[model samples]
Target: MSRWILVGVLWLAGASAAFAIDQEIAFSDPSMNTRYLSLIREIRCPKCLNESIADSDAPVAADLRREVRRLMGDGKSDDDIKDFLSARYGDFVLYRPRVSETTWALWAGPFVFLVIGGIVFWRIVRSRLGQPLDDEESAA
Candidate 1:
């Protein structure tokens, strides 16, 4: 019975330890915590599609969270931190890449495709509504 009690206490401690945030990021400033959270929400987890770094439990995401905190500690503005990470990684690291020449296709490709699809649909409908041309009509 004593051994079981000891095991229970150890289990509770271990469970709490697992949920604790990284010690290095115990910010005294509440604003810093808020800033970090906001920045993490905007950063994409490279290993997880459609998941922000804040929501991802992957190791890479954890490292990125720490790095963002470190950069915040260094007094980097949000844009500066984003630019730094974007430089190290790529635009894919950003949840929303900035609009620029390189990303013109990324920004406009979907709309262009939609327009093209609409034109094709219109042509198909028009063709289907027209009378079918028989060989006699063609000869005329």
Candidate 2:
């Protein structure tokens, strides 16, 4: 039992080591480093769905990190870097996409769906309860 446990622990350690991602950041200025960290935290990895480039281990995430760093080194503002990524990968690359015509559905879709659902639910409940929808209908 001890031998089996030892093997299991060693195997788990090796697996964890293999799955570890590089968390290094190279920036000359402290402010740039701060911005870089912020950018990474705010930018989603296109290939990783819900994971940010900072948290994802995918190759695409590494590539995005490199691109963001390079853009910063080129004196691009945070907005510029965000725009570059958003232009290339669309609003999904941005964790907080701006509200615009193209993204209106993304911003308002849930509420619209909720309102529609509420109306349907109200109608279903009213019908099941044999309640009249209007006073005129009840009188007739």
Please tell me which predicted candidate would have the highest TM-score against the true structure.
2
How does each model score on lDDT? 0.79, 0.81
lDDT of 1 at 139: 91
Judged by lDDT against the true structure, how good is candidate 2?
0.81
Prediction RMSDs, each to the true structure = 11.4, 10.4
Task: Tell me the deviation in Å of residue 54 in model 2.
Answer: 0.5
- Please provide, for model 1 over 16-39, each residue's C-alpha lDDT reduced to its tens digit, 9 standing for 90 to 100: 432444434435575676567668
Off by over 4 Å in 2: 1-23, 105-140
Q: What TM-score does candidate 1 reach?
A: 0.58
- Model 1 residue-pair collision total: 0
